[model samples]
Each structure stands twice: as C-alpha cells, then as structure tokens.
Target: MKSRRAILAELFLTAASLMALFPLAWMVSVSLMPPHDAVGFPPPLWPSHPTLANYRELFAHQNMGRYVLNSLIVASLATVLSLAFNVAAGYAFAKLRFAGRDRIFRGLLAALIIPGQLSMLPLFFLMKELGLLNSYGGVVVPFMASLFGIFLVRQYALGLPDEMLQAARVDGASEVQIFLKIVLPNLRPIMVTLGVFTFLSAWNDFLWPLIVLSHDQLYTLPLAVASLSREHVQDSAMVMAGAVVTTAPVLVLFLALQRHYVRGLLAGSVKG
Candidate 1:
C-alpha cells in the first residue's frame, strides 16, 4: 500500500509539473510557428512549419538586442549594489552594537507595509530633483537596497555562530576583514538567493523603468516587448518570441540557481 501511494504521489506531481509548464512550452511552440500560425484555428499546440522569421525580425528591426543589453546592465548593477548594501546593513543589524538599531530596522519593516505605488509620485519628484530621471541611475538607485533583502540576510546571519565574530575581533580583525573572510563565506546560501531575487526583480521590472526611461534606447526587455505588442498586435508569433526573449534569461538563471535558492530559504527560516 505504501509503494502504491508513493507511485500515485509521483504521478500526481508529474501531472502538476506538466500543467504548470505547458503554457511555456506552448509559447515556444507558437514562437517557432510560421506567421499567423500561432493564432490559427484550434490554436495549434505545435508548429506545422517552424521558422526563425519572428526571432530574425526582432533582432534585425526591433532593436531587441539593445533592449536586452539595457536590461542586463540594469539588472547586474541592481543585483551587485543591493547585495553589497543589504549584506552590510543586515550584518550590522545582526551583530553590531549601535543605538536605535532595532528601532531603525523596525521602522524599515513598517515602511514595507506602505504600498509602493503610493510613493511613486513622490519618488518621481525626488528623482527629478536629483536629475536621475530618464537615466540608468534612476532605474538602478531605487532598487539598491530592499527591506526584505536585508531582513532575509539578517535572519540567516543571526544563526551564524557569534563566537566566530568574537574570535575574529579578539584576533584584531577589522570589521571589513571579518565580513569578507568569515561572515560572507557563511552567508553563501542567502547571498545566492538574494542575488538571484534581485537580478530577476530588476530584469523583469517594467513599470519603474517605463516611468523613468523616456528614450527608446534605454528601454528594457519588458518595455520593448510591450512596445512590440502594441506595434505588432497581429503578429502573435512575434509577440511570443519577444516574451521568450524577455523570460529566458531569468528562467535560466533561476534554474541554474534553484538549489542555492531552496537552500537559502530553508536555512533562513529554520536556522534562526
């Protein structure tokens, strides 16, 4: 009976996986289909005649490559800057002795309760004042530190043996040296998870980029895809191709880092 139940569970899981992934598969299939094939009768699941025309058009005319590059730059910058800032802040909160540190952290957590949309107008005004609007700095600056990222890191770091930091201090190690040599190595799982989260969030960001970036050249993949959709509404296959392009990088990144992400989540939750 146990063996039978195990097989049944496996079967159920397999079906659920297929159900979740079917749309992605369909999107790729449609992208490969010839023009008008994606929107054809019965909504064909597979391409009758596969062609690279949609992808070719995107690269050749739509300036998709430039958009992809823009996204890469934005995402990479956001991830690196956020990682550095959040790790330091989190470690400070977890280990350092400072007045009102807990109060300040609680204030940050309270800020998270406020809807982000409510602040956009003020944020935009602030950006304009700083002369960062319509620039890469505009997009990258706002995401460089997130409360959730800091919280995640703090939670993970809290479980790290305090003795290590004390020993490093006793040995006359500086704060920077301790963080680099001891804390960072121990926080590997959380770092990978946070890095992946930041990268994907920045890569997939559309609303902020659209609001901040006015020039066509600064358009990210999601913005470019939206433009493509409006301009080529009838070209379903082309739109699908754009979706694939916008989604593929993050998908690959997540899959590659899936183990680290899961490990980080488990460690952060269970350790502390």
Candidate 2:
C-alpha cells in the first residue's frame, strides 16, 4: 500500500508539472502554426504544417535581430561592469580594515530596502543631463553596480582566510595583484552566478529602458516585444515567436548555470 501510494504521488506530481509547462508548450505549438490557425475555436495542440514564416517575418520585416543585439549588448555590459564593481567593493568590505566600514556597509544594506522606482525620476534627469538618454549608455548606466551584487560578493568573500591575504602581502604582492590573481580566481563560481543574475535582470528590464530609450532602433527585446504586441494584437503566432526569441537565451543560460546560481544564493543567505 505504501509503495502504491508513492507511485500514485509521483504520477500526480508529473501531471502537475506538465500542466505548468503547458502554456510554454502551447506557445511554441501556436508559433509554428500558419498565421490564422493559432486562434481556432478548438485550439490545435500541434501545428498541422509547421512554418518558420513568423520568425522570418520577425527578423526580415520587423528587424527583431536589432532588438536581440541591443538586449545582448546592454545585459552583457551590465553584467561585466557590475561584477567588477561589486566584487571589488564587496572584498574591501569583507577583508580590508577601514574606519566606519561596518557602519557604511550597514547603511548600504539599509538603502537596499528602498525601491529602485523611487529614484527613476531623478535618474532620468541625471541621464539626460549627461546626454545618455535614448542611448545604450543610459540603459546600462543605472545597472552598472547593484546593491544585491555587492551583498552577494561580500557574503562569499567573508569566508576567505585572512592569513592568505597577509601571506600575499608578505610576498610583496600588491592589493591589486592579490585581488586580480588570488581573490578573483577563488570567486569564479559566485561571479558566474552574479553574472547570470545581472544579465537576466538587465535583459528583462522593461520600465527603465522604456522610459529612457525613445528610439525604435535602440529597442531591447522586451521593449520591442511589448510594442509589437500592442500594434500586432491580431498576430498571435508572430507575437509568440517574438516572446520565444526574447525568452530563449535567458532560459538557456539559467538552465546551464542554475547550480552555481543556487549555490551562490544559499551561500549569501547563510552567511549574510
């Protein structure tokens, strides 16, 4: 009876998992259907005749490739820059002796509770003043350094031995050498985790990019998809194709790096 019940429970969970993934499966199905077939009264589970016309139309006519490139550029730049800044600051807070370090770090932690939206208006004005509005620089600037990234790095860095740093110093290794050679290599797993997090956040960011970037040519995938959905409400297949394109890369990245990401999250939570 116990074995039977366990088997039944596993079957039930499998059904639930399929149900959760059904929307995505359906979207892909619909995206391959011929233009008008997606919204039929009795929806088709699979396209009778799968077609890549939607994807072709997206790239050729709508110039979705540009949007993809924009998303890639902004997200990658933000990830790289944020990692550099956060790791340095976090290591300093974790190991370096300095006056008021704890107090300042605490203040930063407190500030993290403040919603990013509260700064949007002022941030926009600041970007405009610096002539960064409607440019990639504007989209990438606000995310160059993040509080969460710093916190994550600091938590990870705190586990390192102080004796290692002292030894490095005794060997005449400068602080920069110590950080670049010794510390950064040890921090790789967390860095990969942070990079994935930062990339996803920047890629999916809609509101800030929407507010700052006015040019269609500069539209990121999320922005372009939203705009496309508005204008092409009738084209369900095409819209789903756009969504697939927008979501696929990030989904792939997550699936590949999820172990490291989860490890980093657990490490930060336990330590912090």
Candidate 3:
C-alpha cells in the first residue's frame, strides 16, 4: 500500500510539473505551427504541420535580429559594468577599513527597501538632461551598479581569508594589485553567479527600456516583442516565436548556471 501511495504521489507531482510548464510548451508548439493553424476555434495542443515560416517572417520583415542584437549588447554591457562597480564597492566594504563605511552601507541597505520604480520619474529626467535619453547609455547608466549587487558581493567577500590580503599588503602590493591578483581569482564563482543575475535582470527589463528608448531602432527584445504583440495581435504564431527568441537565451543561461545562482541566493540570504 505504501509503495502504491508513493507511486501515486510521484505521478501527481509529475502532472503538476507538466501543468506548470504547459504554457511554455504550448508557446513553442504554436510558434512552430502554420501561421493560421494556431488560432483555430479550439487551439491545437500540437502542431498539425510544423513550419519555420513564422520565424522567417520575424527576422525578414520585423527586424527582430536588430532587437536581439540590442538586447545582447545592452545586457552584456550592464552585466560587465555592474560587476566591476559592485565587486569593487563590495570588497571595500568587506575588507578595507574606512570611516563611515558601515553607516554608508546601512544607508544603502535601507534604500533597497524602496522600490526602483520610485526613482524612475526623476531618473528619466536626469537622463534627459545628460542627453542620454533614447540612447543605450540611458538604459545602461542607471543600472551600472546596484545596492543588492553590492550587498551580495560584500557577504561573499566577508567570508574570504583576510590573511591573504595582509600577505599581499606585506609584499608592498598596492590595493588595486592585491584586489586584481589575490581577491579577484578567489571571487570567480560569485562573479559568475552575479554576472548571471545581472544579465538576466537587464535582459528581461521592459519598463525602463520602453520609457527611455522612444526610437524603434533602439528597442530591445522585450520592447520589440511587446510592439510586435500590439501590431500583430492576429499573428499568434509569430508573436510566440518572438517571445521564444526573447526568452530562450536567458533560460539557457539560467539552466546552465543554476547551481551557482542558487548558491549565491542562499549565501546572500543567510549572510544578510
């Protein structure tokens, strides 16, 4: 009876998992279906006949390729720049002695409690004043560093051996050299984890890019996909294709680095 119950439970869990993933599966199935086949009176769970016509249409006429490139460049740049800024500030907060460091960090932590949206109106105006509006810099500048990123790095760095830093100091190594040579190598795992987090966040960001980038030419994938959805409401297959293109890279990145990502989450939660 116990064995039978266990088997039943497993089946139930598997069904639940499938249910959760059904939308994604359906999206892919429909995207591969013939353009008109997806929107029948009763939607088909599986494609009757699969075709690449929707994908071809997305790239050929919709200029989705440019949007993909925009997302890639913006996401990559944001990740790299955020990593540099946060890692440096985090390491300083963790290892270096300075006046008011703890107080400043506490202030930042408090600031994190406020929603990012609260700053958007002011931030947009600031970008406009700097002539960064409608440019990549406008989207990338505000996100170059983050309070959460700094906090995460500081937590990880706090656990690192201080003796290694002292050894580097004793050797007359400058702060920058010690950070580059001694600290950065040891930070590889956290860096990978942080980079993934930053990349995903930036890539998936919709509202800021939508507000800042008025030019269709500068639209990232999410923005472009949204625009396509509005313009091509009848083209369910094509819109799903766009969503697949927009979501696939980040999904792949997450699946590949999920272990590190989970570890970082745990470390941050426990340490903070």
Candidate 4:
C-alpha cells in the first residue's frame, strides 16, 4: 500500500528526527564519560568508563539541589498563577459582555508584536518599587499573566457552547460558580497546554531570574548550570552533566503531555 514517495518521506523524517536528537543523545553520553574524555578530537560516542562522579560533584560540591528546588518553586508558582489569571481573563474576553472589552483585547493583541525585552526595564523598576525585587515573587510575577496565554485560552474558549453557559446563568449560577463548575472542565486541553507552556518557560528562564535573584541560595537550575560551566570550564563532562540535569525534567514533562499540548493547539487554531 506504500508508494515510493511515501517511503522516501518516511526515511527523510526519520533521518531528520535522528539528526535533531543526536546532540542531546551526545550530551547524555558525554555526561556519563570521564572528565576530559569528551573534549578529545573526534569525540567518542560512548563512555568507556561511565560514572556518576560528575553528578555527585554537582550535587555534593555545587549545592545544585537548592537551585533545583528554587526552580521548582518558581515554575510551579508561575504556572498556577498563569492559569488562574490568564484563564479567567481569556474566558471573559471570549464569552462575557463588558464595556471596552474588545478595545482592550485588541490593544493586548497589538502588543504581541512588540519585543518583550523592551518591557524588562520598566518591569524591573516596577518590581523594585513594589519591594518585590530579589525575591521569588519578582521572578514569578512578570509571567503570571501573558498576552499569548490570554489569546490561546480565548481562542480555545471561543469554541465552548454558548448555550451551556447561558443555561448555567439561567439556573442562577453566579459567574464564579459557573466558571468553576462549568467552564474549567471544558477547558482542560487548553489549560494543560497553557500550564505546560508556563512551567517550561519559567523552568528554563535564565535572564530574568539572573537579574532578579542576588543570593546564591535563590539561583535557579539554568543559572546554576551556567555558573557550573564557568567554574568547570575544562571539565566538559561535568558541564554536560549539569546541562542534562537542567534539561531533563522539562523534557520529560513535555514528552508526557505532548499529546494534550498538540490537541489544544490544533483545537484553538480552528475553533476561532
């Protein structure tokens, strides 16, 4: 049942996948290698003497566990807050009637084109003024409500049956109760998509956290990995191990939830 073209396409895709994955695979392989073995010309693909020494060095000497915990705390808080704010705002934009709603949403959508970097200075100053600087709240607050998140949720929520919402309203359900009881359950796919997006963004964030967190105790995994690279410049294997540790959790989370993420994107794209 397969044509030559189909076979060729499959082969091309397989090759592309392997090519994309090769570097990550090599990173893991190098992480397992002994120090300096990875820096050799024509680096070996497999470790001759695999060991956990680099990981041990990272956790034991570098205090990497604290960084991991910090990242977890920041990312979890950001994801939860992003869901809370973006979901409500998005649903309101989609289904609720309010004065100036369209104009406000249009202004937000227009803002999507502006570079996010431009806002950093003002945001930093705002954080400083609020006394949130140099704290976890500083890292989490900026990402708690994002325009893209609002747009994604709004687009997906547009597809929800208006009749169901109206019926809930007629039954004398308060807006909060209706949203909690009716809307949230229907918005599961998009919620997962948004949550995963927020979590990954917060987890891997480097620059904002770097600027905001002053204490070594507050360093996140990306910052920790960067610092490790600086301290262990010659120890490529150790650096690779640090990279692996920084990358692995989010990679696992994405792989686990990719189906839902893809479905949400697809549904949102067409629903509006």
Error of 1 at 132 (Å): 1.5
lDDT of 2 by residue, 108-216 (tens): 9888778999999999999999999999899988788888888888888989999999999999999999999999999887899888888999999999999999999
lDDT of each: 0.87, 0.89, 0.89, 0.89
Q: Choose 1 or 4, whichever is better by lDDT.
A: 4
Which parts of model 2 have CA positions greater than 4 angstroms off? 1-5, 39-43, 267-272
* Candidate with more favorable, higher lDDT: 1 or 2: 2
Residue pairs whose backbone atoms clash in candidate 1: none
lDDT of 4: 0.89
Model 4 regions lying over 4 Å from their true place: 36-43, 264-272
Q: How many residue pairs collide in each prediction? A: 0, 0, 0, 0
Q: What is the lDDT of candidate 3?
A: 0.89
Model 2 scores a TM of 0.94
Against the true structure, what is each candidate's TM-score?
0.90, 0.94, 0.95, 0.92
Q: Candidate 1 vs candidate 3: which has greater TM-score?
A: 3
Q: At residue 43, what lDDT does model 1 achieve?
A: 54
In the predicted model 3, the residue pairs found to clash are: none
Model 3 poorest ten-residue lDDT run: 263-272
The 10-residue segment with the lowest total lDDT in model 2: 263-272
